[model samples]
Structures are given as structure tokens and as C-alpha cells.
Target chain A: MQERLYSAPGCTSEERFGEASAAGETLGERMRRSLEQDIARGDLAPGARLDEKEIAERFGVSRTPVREAFRLLAANGLVELRGRQGAIVREIGVNQLLEMFQVMAELEGLCARLAARRITPAQRAMMSDIHARLEAMGEENDPARFYQINLEFHEVIYEASRNDFLAEQTRSLRNRVGAYRLRVTYLPERVRHTLKEHAEVMEAIFAHDAERAHAAMRAHLTLLGDDLIDFIAQFGKE
Target chain B: MQERLYSAPGCTSEERFGEASAAGETLGERMRRSLEQDIARGDLAPGARLDEKEIAERFGVSRTPVREAFRLLAANGLVELRGRQGAIVREIGVNQLLEMFQVMAELEGLCARLAARRITPAQRAMMSDIHARLEAMGEENDPARFYQINLEFHEVIYEASRNDFLAEQTRSLRNRVGAYRLRVTYLPERVRHTLKEHAEVMEAIFAHDAERAHAAMRAHLTLLGDDLIDFIAQFGKE
Candidate 1:
């Protein structure tokens, strides 16, 4: 069996990543998170079968809850249900990944544009604070920490948009794509380019220029030209 | 109680509104469509309680499927499951509606932009055909027909974007908002304005002007300033 899934992926950091968070979260949900983390970390490869009896015994649970957990996983697109073959980790096609990336770029751009127009003083300070931390990284490339912090930087903009529904949708999309991206290591040169682009987005938002913020953020994240070609190559290996 | 829900809301017109469609659709799914249509038409008003036994009797089904259907409704945001009290139709807040509208506009704009860049001759012809139908309506105002055709016009662009995932998401958003918009009647004046706006979108797409197509489509559909004000007033009435 796979794992249970959250309908709303993440409204906050605690809901998203905390191992033992969200009061009243069911046992199935916790197990689901453990399995989800395993999948994201590539411990469970794509197309790998999640045997019901095996997983149930491994997790020290009965088949009933395990079956329910597999249903949840299927709902989350983490697993595909085959008639008699139980559940298998979904193999995401490159076309679908590309489509997701394109949508994510536009949604991020909208968040940036909204943040430029609607950010509060505290939100502005938070953005600047994150910006400074990223800039402080200099030439040192740490993919793990960079990935974590990059998410924080984006989350700030999503929160600043002042639209919970919009933010929730964006976060759900982010969670869906996160597994694929987790497999890719950030290169030193790519990190350098990303730092420069972050500055461009930050400057636009600081000046309260919505159009510029939208354009700048789109440029920063859009996988086009060489970036897209590089992603396809990396994706094939994953 | 309530109705079952489709996870992927309307990947096509047939899946969205057809009574006899989608081969092998479950009995619960069929009942769901009837109830969903009832809700959309205001026959089942917002905040209405859906009694499990009563609904089961009405649909000539057992309590088991009724409960399963209610769960599906809750998942789709069509109903709220309140502990042991059973399910009630969900009440959407004004702020949430506005947020959804804003997101929908941007998604449609992205479709238009991509359509301009990637549209084939066949897609271009289809867009022209829909545009002609819309223009032919002229001052002969029919809100129901206009709304139906307007969706077709937008769907054409969505298809032309050549991204199935993006198109599917856009369609899902359209379905979510359809219930709310179903209550509003387009005045003759609004129809004239729609015609003018559609012409602008059509012209931009015909010329392969991606930026203009994006901006024009946003302008066409965005609920901003006066349009938003009017919508809020109308929404309150609904």
C-alpha cells in the first residue's frame, strides 16, 4: 500500500513538512506522510509496485487501513491502481512535467505581481530577510538547503497575495511537482544565475512595480530555451 | 446525500453537461449529475441539508451508496460533512468567489497567449467559427445561449494552447465557477461589450500577437472595477 494524502497539500510549513504535526491527523495520514517522504527522496522509485501485504506488515498495520492509504495515494497521483496488481508509483511523463512547470511559472508570476501590489510592511521585511540570506550563500552550493530556502522565498510571495484560495492552489501544484524536482541537484552555476534572478524579482517588488515583478519572476522560474533543454536531460536520468 | 463528484471536472463538454455520457459511469455519478444540475439551477439552494435516508429513498438507492456519494460531494466542495449530522450544501463566501474569478482570468489569459503562439490552422478555423456565432447573435440577447457559446469560445483557445494539463485545469476552474455564474443574466449592453472584447481577442490571435492576445483575453474576462462591483451585487442576490 502507498499512503494517505492531504486534500489540501499545504496551507503552512507545519502542515506540509512536520513529521508529527496537524493535531487529529489520523494514523493513516502519518503513515502516508512517511511514505510520501520516501517517494520524494527517491527511496521508492517510479513504477515500483507497493505490495499491500508487504507494506502492511512492514508498517505494522492490517490490510484494511493499508488499502485505504493506497486509495489516498492514488488520489494524490503518488500511485496508480492496477486491477489485480495492487498500486504502483506513478511514472510521470515528460510532457506532463513540462505542462506542470509551465503552469507553475505563470502561477508564481501572478503571486509576484499580487505581492508587488498588496504586500504589507511585515511581508516586505520577510522578503528582504530571505533575500539577504540567499545572497549570503555566495558561491557555496548546497542543493538541500537551497531547495528548502527557495520554497520559503516563494511561500512568502504566495502568502503576501492575500488570497487564501489562490495560495492553496499554488501550494498544491508545488507539492505535486516537488517530487520530480527533488531528484535534480542544483548546479553551482545555476545557483549563481538563480541568485541574480532573485535580485531582479526583489527589486521589482520593492519598487511596487507589478508588471515588472510579473515579468521578472516569470523570467526567473520559466524553464525555456537552454533551461528547458537541460531539464529534459536531467529528467530522463531521474 | 448530496451528490458524487468527478475529480477531473469536465475534460470536455460531454463530460461536463451531458446526461448520457462517459461510458461505464457509476450509478452514483449519474445521480450526482442530477443533484449537481439541481444545485446549479437553484432548485437545491446553498445551505440546504441533504438527508441521507431521504436522498436514498428519492434516488431509489440504498444508504451505502448515498453515504459514498456524500463523501464524493464533500471532496468536490459541493457539500460540508458536519460530524454525525450528515452533509449540507456548502456556502461559498464572496471573497473566495472573487479569488477564484481572479485566478480563472489569469489562467484563461495564459491559454490565449499560448494559443496565439501555438495554434494550428484547424484550431484557428474553429476559433473563427465560434467567434462568428457569437457575432451573429448581435443585439438578440440570450444569456443562457451566450454563456454556453462563450464557454465554447474559451474552450477553443484552451485547446489551441496545445497543453492538455493546462486546458484540463482551466476547464476545472470553469466548472467550479459555473454554478455561481449560472444565476447571472447578461444584459443587452453587456452582450455588446462582450462582442467587442471577443473581436479584440480574435484579432490578436489571428495576427499571432501573443502579448496582445493575453492582455485582450484578460480584459475580456477579468472582473475588475465596475465589472467586479456589478458581479458582487449580483452575487449577493444569488
Candidate 2:
């Protein structure tokens, strides 16, 4: 795991290069998504200075939309815009990151519990399909593919929970934690471990054991001991 | 409890018209806070229409800043922007509201659990002081005072949790839920009930019982049986 840097697994179209994704989004939205993918992929490293003029030129857009893109990124908690200091990709503080993971574990636990109780047959089938694909892909998975599919796997659970508001809140927080979580996909063994953990969560849900599902999901997401150390290690230089 | 509607208990400085609150907030931000208060107080009821020209005139500003204010309101989940049909005060669907409350319960539970373990002397004192004030206020509590102090009480727990990320997320969701929860403050007996629930939560926190604190807080926020019935009833003419 130390020898490997996390990337995509069994990946396809990890970055939605062209889809507007939502109504009313403009050039700023496209630029934000593109820049987000770059930052998530480590092409734009954490704490790296963001030159607005350079970005404008790179995106082949005017400074106005570029500024809007920066604002949106800041709102998403991916970038920091200091009054005089301009903007930079945010490198989350260790304490803030730990707090985020803690909250994430709890929210995932909630989703798993709801999903266990409410999942429909179709949703269950989809989750099973994704679970099987993850296992079947084995060594061929790319960090990009892994991230996209893993997101889909979780989306199924969120949908199965039949709680749109909860799902939206969970997804919003996940986006804020995106870059770091994506890094885990590059760790080959971590992906394998994640597969096993997902199996445990899936089993609990399949058994209609809400408490067990919640516990399994919480255990899967909570970092302790060596896991926490690995996260701190992967977090780049300040 | 049915005859008693919620309101304030020993409140002061319910609305801060004088303070800018934060730097860089302009006329648009000021308008946002004002309108938010109006909506929360039921001066602007859910499902009410918001006319851009009318609001611009009322706020003594140009339509430009008013539009920006509307955008901010929509972002806060207090307003719905409907293209050429114009904006309306958002009346959240029952299902979405239930989902929001569910997530809110989980988040508050997480805070309570953490606060139980990490609360410092200062935070503990602040919480106790607020609890005493709420209890001491008796029948004198107004809706505004009740809302304000209750916020302070929760803020102490959030601070005590030593998890800024979780606190920020919880606060953001609370803001989105403000209009609805403020209505709860107007239910007089609900405030009394809340005081009892807060006492339970405080006891668990003070005793350093993490699991009990978590359960207490979750129980405090969760609407159950007739509580849910009353919430729907008080949701107003929607």
C-alpha cells in the first residue's frame, strides 16, 4: 500500500467531461467541474496557488466566469479565497478532516439503517449488481472507475433509504470530502478491503437487520490506529 | 399541550438589526437576514409570493440587490425560484421535512455524544447557565427569547463536541430548518416539553455518558406520534 498511490479502478467516464448535469448551469459550472476533477486527481495539489488569469486562459473563458468558478469551488469547501491572499486549493486541517470523517461515519450509518428497512427489490438488485461488479473487476479497476462505481453503489443505498433530503445532505458532505476519499481508490489493498466491508454492510441489509447494517457501515468508514496514520501520511506536505 | 402553542421564554435581543454580523456582508446580505426573520416569525408565511419589484421598493434598494437577496434566500432553502413565474416562499413538502428532521436528529445525536466526551469547563458552565435561564424564565418566555437562548444552548454542545466540521454542517442544516423549527418555539407547551428534554440531555452530557447523551438528544429532536401530528397541524394553512 505504501508503494502505491491511489487512483481509479475498473473506471469509465469518471469525469463527466460535457454533461451540464443540471439545468441553468453555465460556463462557470463546467470550469468548476473540470478544475474539481484535476484537483481530485492531484494535478492541482492541495494548497497549490490558483492563478485566476492562468485558469481563465486554460479554460478559454473570461475572468468573470473564472471568478464565479472560484466562488462555487469555495462554496463546495474545495478552495479557500482569502481577502488579499486570493485563492488556493484548500488543504484541510487535520482536526477538520477528522471531524468530517466522524460525521461521515454517522451519516453513512443512518443511511444504511434506513436502507436496510426500506430497500425495494429493484434497489436491492442494483446494489447486488454493483457489489458483484466490484468483486469481479478485481485488479483491473482504475481509481476513476472505482470512485464512480463506488459512488453508484452508495447512491443505491441512499435511494433505497427513500429519503431524498438525507441523501442530498449526505452527498453534499461527500463532495466536500471528495478529493481525500478518492485517493483511497488508488490504494489497491484498501479497495479490496472496502469490497469486503461492503460485503458485510450488504449482508446486514439483506438480512433486514437495521442495527447490524448501521454498525457495519459505521465500522467501514471510521478510521482508527493504522488507518488514521495512513490518512495522515497520504495527506500531502503543507 | 394541544392548547399550548410554543413561544419565547425570557428573551432579549431576538433580532440584531444593528449588527452586520460578519464582514463583507452588504445590502443584499442585510436584506437576506431581515427577510429570513420575517419568514421565521411567520410575517412571511410559507407558500407566500415574493414580488421582486415590491421587495426592492420595500427594502429601499434597486432590483439588482433584491435579486441577489432572492438568490441568497433560495440558496438558504427559504425561497423557491420558479423561472418566469417568479419566487415564492418555499413550503417544504411533508416527506422532505420528515427526512430533514431525521438527519437533524442523527447530527444532533453525534454532537451530544462528542460533547459528552470532550466538553470543557467553560462550555459546561455556559450550557448549565442557559439551562437554568430557560427553567427560571417560567411563563415569561416569548417566542423570540426562547428561540435565541435555545440556539445558545445547542451552540454550547456543538462547541463542546470539539468538532468544528460537524458543528458547521449541523448549523447549516439548522438554518435551512429555521422557519419550521421557529414555529415549534411558538408552541408554548412545546417549549416546556423542550426544557424537560434539554434537562435530560444535559444530565447525560454532564454525567459523561456518551451513549445516553446521544439517545437523549435524538429523542429530543425526533417527532413522535402526536408530536408528528401536532407538527403537521401547526405547519399552517399549507
Candidate 3:
């Protein structure tokens, strides 16, 4: 399989361009979304410099908004801003990637524990739907599609936990660490294993066994961690 | 007990101004430091608009660095960047404040659990020293000094955990929720209660009981939730 630059899949450039036409929004926020979409879609690369003027021209805005977008990115740890230096996209290392997965596991474990006790019927229905979609994709194994559904599956678990703050934070950290997850798509077996793990997690959650669900989620993330290390070793730049 | 603007008790304009010039850091980093100091010291109110030009002029730099600084702040969630509306400091309601403390409790609990297994002799000694200082202040009740030392006590726990990612994430979240933590101070008897809680947490960590340490930390943060609610009712903006 050929390696491609990762970008957020659902958001297209056309939609991003149309974002500039909206009113009452700061240029910073609009450009931030557009740029995040760009990064998500693999249009941008790690360590790439973000030229404020160039981006401003592209977005039909002043340097102010483009500059503001850069700041938001920097805050998110997506980019690094140097004093006299310009902003550059940050790259992830294997160690940092593993650390992120470890934290993600803990958070997922927490969500499962909460969801087991708190999940509503509607949320459980959503979880079932997402799990079904994810399970359907397991045989075909389209990495991107599987990943998307997988995200939804975990998100439903977070929502079922009935803790908005926990959900928001888990989502934010997930976004912050997206680069690493996307880069690990080269491992075919990883996809298969992840699908199997998701099945187990769903079963545990569905049974309302909080401890089992938490353990399953933790084990799933740990598997991702092991696969991530292998991918990074092969692909990581020195 | 007078309610005034959110300025540090001892910080004059000079001391606040000195933070920007004290180090030979880059413009962006220096500005970030200055802004954080202001926020921590209570000079910048939540929902306050940060005008780029004005901030640039204040720090004797161009809008470039100030804008970069804003991005750093936004990343930490100290401010929100509305697309065209400009950046405003974020405000947390009582429920949101409780959410933050709940997450804080979990993260700190994780830290203590790890620290129990990993803490070194030097780190243990440092923690003991910090606790002794906090204990000494129990009678004097010096809020400012106590607060500073209290921070150090938590820092040692995080560091002892020996996970860079978890420590950094926790520290960042703690700062992001700084305003709310400050609000909790106005609650009656909170200071005394907090000191007592700190001692219990320290004792657990010292005894190397991971579960006990985790429980103590969680209980401490739970009390903080009550204090924060009282503060919101008494002084929070409508």
C-alpha cells in the first residue's frame, strides 16, 4: 500500500474555502478550521512553515486573521512559533506517541467505567449503531473508514458516560494526537486487531459491565501503542 | 475582606511590567510569560478582549510577537479566538468549574498512583520539605506563601509520577483552569480545610500507598468543588 499524507477525511477543501464567506466569525477561527482541515487531510506536512501573508492571500483576509489562526494552532501544540522565526508544524516521536496512547487508554477506561453506570438507552443505541458500522468494515478493512467509525464508537462511550467535560477533553487530546494515529495506517494487522478489540469493548459496554468495558478499552489502546511503535520505527524521520 | 479587581496582592505595575523584561527570552515567549503572569495574578479578567495593537505597543514589539503570544494562550484554553470577533478570555461557570476540578482530581490521582511506585529518595525529601513548610504555615495562615508552596507540593507529585506526557497535560489543564481555582479561595474555611487535606495527601504519598494517595487526592479536589460553588454564588459575574 502507498503511504499518503493524512488530513481529516470528511472536511474537504471546498467546504473550507466556503468557510471564509461566513459572517460574525473571527478570521482567526475560520482560518484555524480551514488549516486544521488542511492538516487533517494531509495537504500540509510536519515541520512546514506557515506563511501568514501567503495564507492570508489564499483565504482573502488580512494578515491579522491568518496570524491569529497560527496562534490557535500553536496553542494546540500543532505548531511551534519561534520569536523571530515563523511557525512550523510539529512532528511526533515514537515515545511521545506511546505516551499519548497510554493517557488515551486511561481516559477511555474512565469513560467505560462511567458509561456502564450512566448510559442512556439513546446513547446505547448510538453505540450499537456505530459498533455495527465498525464491525461491517472489519472484513473489508478500509483503514480510513474504519478509523472514522472507530472514533464514533469511542465518542459514544464518552457521551454515554454523561460527563461533558470528560468527553470534551478526551476529544481535544485525541485531536492533538491525531498525527501519530494517522501515521500508523501502514500496519495491516493493526487494523484487524483493532477491529477485534473494538468488538470486545462493545460487548463489555453493552453488557453494562463497567470493569470489563474499562479493561477492554485499555487493552485496545495498548495494542495500538504496540503497533504505533513498529510503524514509527519504520517511518520516523531522524 | 474587600472584593476588588484580580491583581496580585503585592504586584505593582512595575513588578508586572518587570516580568516581560526579566529574561532574554524571545518576544513570543516573553509575551506569553507576561500574559500568563497577568492572568495568574488576576490583572486580566475572564472574557476580556486582548487587543493586539495595544498589547504590541505595551510590550514595545510589533503585532507579530503579540499575535504569537495570543496563539500560545489560546492553545492552553486561557482565551478563545472567535473568527472575526477577536480573542476573549474564557470564563467558566460553576458547573464547568466543578468539571475542571473533577478532571484535575483524576489526573492528580493518577500522578499519586504512579509516584507511589516511582518516587525517588531525592524527590521524597523535597516533598517532605515542602510539606513541612506547608505545615508550618497552618498556624500563620499566610495565603500567598501557602498558595505558592501548595503548588510546589503538587508539582513534586506530578514529577514523581515520571510520565512526561501526563505531567505536562495535567500542568497545562491546571493553568487553563487557574481562574476558577482562584475563585474557590473566597469560600469560608476553605483555606484551613485545604491545608488539612494537603497533609493527608502528603502522608499517603510518603507511606507509598498508591491507592490511599489516589483517594486522598480525589477527596481533596472534591472539597475544592464545594468551595468553588460557594465562590461563584458570592462573587461570580452574572
TM-score of each: 0.82, 0.84, 0.85
lDDT of 3 by residue, B28-112 (tens): 7677877876776567877678888877776677988777777778777677777656677776665666767777778888888
- Lowest-sum lDDT 10-residue window in model 2 chain B: B1-10
Residue B213, model 3: lDDT of 88
Candidate order by decreasing DockQ: 3, 2, 1
Instruction: Please state the i-RMS of candidate 2.
Output: 2.6
Candidate 1 positional error at A161, Å: 1.0
lDDT of each: 0.74, 0.77, 0.75
- The Cα error of candidate 1 at residue B124, in Å, is 2.1
User: What lDDT is reached at residue B50 by model 2?
Assistant: 82
Top model number, lDDT: 2
lDDT per residue as tens, model 2, B1-238: 0111233232211244345566765565577777776666556667788888887765567886566567667755788877567788888887777788899899999999999999998888999999999878767856677778888899889889989888988887787777777755557777778899999999999999999999999998884323655778775644
Model 1: colliding residue pairs: none
lDDT by residue (tens digit), candidate 1, A1-238:
4433422233332233445556655555556666676666556777778887887777677775566556556555677876556788888787777887888788889999998999999998998899788878766666667877878898999999888878988887777767667544276667778778888888898899999999998887773324655866865754
* CAPRI rating of model 1: acceptable
Candidate 3 off by > 4 Å: A1-15, A19-22, A53-62, A207-211, A233-238, B1-6, B20-28, B47-71, B80-88, B183-196, B203-209, B230-238
Q: Give the alpha carbon lDDT tens digit for every residue of B1-238 in model 1.
A: 4443432233332234345656655555556666666556555667878898887776677775566556556645677777667678778777777788888888989999999999999988988899899888877666667888988998999999998989988887777667667554375667778788888998998899999999998887773324655877865754
For candidate 3, give the lDDT of residue B142.
Answer: 64
Stretches of candidate 2 exceeding 4 Å from the true structure: A1-38, A41-43, A51-65, A224-228, A234-238, B1-18, B21-35, B49-72, B84-86, B224-228, B234-238
